[model samples]
Target: MSTIAAISTPAGVGGIAVIRLSGSEAKTIAERFVRPLSDHKATYTPFVADGDTVDETMVTYYQAPHSYTGDDTVEIACHGSLYIQQAILQHLIAAGARLAEAGEFTRRAFLNGRLNLSQAEAVADLINSTTEASNQLALSQLRGGYQQKLKEMRQELLDLTALLELELDFSQEDVEFADRNRLLSLSENIENEAMRLVESFRTGNAVKNGIRVAIVGKPNVGKSSLLNALLDDDRAIVSNIPGTTRDTIEDTVTIDGLLIRFIDTAGIRHTDNPIEQAGIDRSMKAAKEADVVVYVVDATDKENLNNPNVPKIQGTTILAINKCDLIDHINTSTPNHIYISAKTGTGLDELKHAIVAPFKEVGDGAMLSNLRHFEAMKCLLAAIRQVRQGLEQGTPSDLVAIDLRDAIHHIGTITGEVTTDEILGTIFSRFCVGK
Candidate 1:
């Protein structure tokens, strides 16, 4: 492979920036800028291009088989000036090193066996993690969380297959070397583990992508005020006039490390104006699409929770009693009513608790956040089920081997023993250049 180089650090002016290079020629190219580049050592020297010193930079070099890509690698930490960063990169490209593709270094790592496919994918997740929950989830997967278990499952399947396939070689003599009861026990364990991962996808998805909560109600129900109170940012426009908010206003807040995106949508009511009707339509759609809908109501209004008009909602609905500070006695005919003043910050904590109630039990176990892994889990489960059924019915060893091989193939996909270039390209393309 050709030598590849790119800016490894985020673009912009920081205290310092990093430019990375990896390949067989990485050390040779780096020597052009700063000679005597000792392996696993950092040298503070002048970086040069075309006999002109560009900047005083710190350079580190790693020998082959020890670097990230399993090739000789060099990293230059230079001043954070954008001009200097570009100058160094352009100079490197001019010196026979080509620009690196998105995630090329990590892709090379995966290719070199430095990391499995799932662990390589986790690098991107770890980099893009915004919340603590996402960070922990990514870190867990990066540390051989689910893939390790898959590897164990694959070993068991391999042992079972080897035993059965060995029987095929001795076909001349009618003999059964494999134990059916043991095969049954091994396949049963694989089935249970596969199902557990499939079930964890729901929780993993919620932690990976924040939950959506739509704060919706009739006009002038303080939905915007409640939104501002929840975020404490006054993000939405509050007005006494109905239909002041003609679009959905959204913001995110972390409750127990789980992201909850609260969308303050337009009031749901009849209107003559087309614009207001459009907003109401969006509000209805948001309610249906949201995971939870907080139905806001005025505490002082004559029509209280006794007969509140809640639009048809598919998600969980919670009754929010806003402007409770204005009324001394809070009367609610429904048991699901939560009295609170968005203006006075009353009962907002309870509202937040209610919002994340369903997701409160998100465990810190290995879970499936990737859709590819989830689908693979399903396939593995199906294949293993067939294997167990075939064994129970006294199917031929060769026939049983087919399903067993298929099950092993599915498990291999998660760790990348069975993969294609297209799949690798698609997975690595999501990463930033230089990894």
Candidate 2:
């Protein structure tokens, strides 16, 4: 195969950037740009271009079938000058290496069977990870945790399929190779496993992305201030007057390894002002859609909290009594209340802990965070349900077998065992160029 080369590290100025080369001729291509740093090198010698040996650098080599793409691979770490990086890449291209396409390295890994489709996708996730939770999840997937689980489930289905097929082959002999009770149990087990993975996607997806947390309250209740405090920046404008914020301002914060997207919405109130009323409508909409609602109340305005006129709260609303520093004395009668001075960053840590508490019950380790995987699991569960119903109704083995096969197909979709070109294209296209 032809050698492929790309700038593996991110673009722009940095301490260093990596240029990666892989394929049958990767070593040969690298040899052109790198000059050995030592005569009898204990470690692999650093290389520099023959004509332009400005600075010595390190070089490591991996032979074919053992490298990232299952091809000979070489990574060059050099000073991150755009011109210098481009020069090295250009020299490699001139020396018979072609530029790799977006995600080509990972795509090659998949094509070479070194990694499955799911694992290859995890490569992108790892690179794009912006939060600790996402990074851990991606690492788990990259290490084959998710793939191994899927493989076990698929093997279970395949075993049952094989037994069913064998029984059909011996139909003329009237043999009962697959016991009825064992078959039902196997189906149940597979269904339960799939259901568990399907259920985890809810929390996993939220954690992989940011959990949407919306700040809701009447105007001038320091919702914007709380947002700025949580984000550690003035992401939203603050004002002493009410109805100052006319739209939702979103900012992401990474707390306790979880990404939380804080959306500070316009204050909720019944206002005759057309612009203010429109903002209030949007606030209500954001409140309904958010995963968690931070219901901010002015500490001085105790009557508003007890007022029946306040709009009905929804979701897991945490009442944040803002402006606590201003109040001479604060009471603790309100349910699920936290006192905070967003201006002074008081009780913010406690609020962050409370926000992440609900998700802690979700087990540590790998989870099915991909939406496609979630959908496939859901389909598998439906098919399994059909099979279960068939068993309960004493349906013929043939009918149950059909449902089982359908379930297998849905499971296969997650690992690309039953995927299409369009699906593959859609998935890999999301990757940045030169991955």
lDDT per residue as tens, model 1, 334-425: 77879889988999999989988876654544788888889988999999999989888988889989999999999998888899887798
Give the least accurate 10-residue stretch of model 1, judged by summed lDDT.
Answer: 357-366
Candidate 1 global TM-score? 0.86
Model 1 spans > 4 angstroms off: 165-175, 217-220, 237-246, 255-257, 266-281, 297-319, 326-337, 357-365, 388-400
Please give each candidate's TM-score: 0.86, 0.86
The lDDT per prediction is 0.88, 0.79
Q: Candidate 2: where is the Cα deviation over 4 Å?
A: 32-57, 169-175, 307-315, 325-334, 343-345, 360-364, 416-419
Give the clashing residue pairs of candidate 1, or none.
none
After TM-score superposition, what is the CA distance of residue 68 in candidate 2 from its true location, in Å? Answer: 1.1
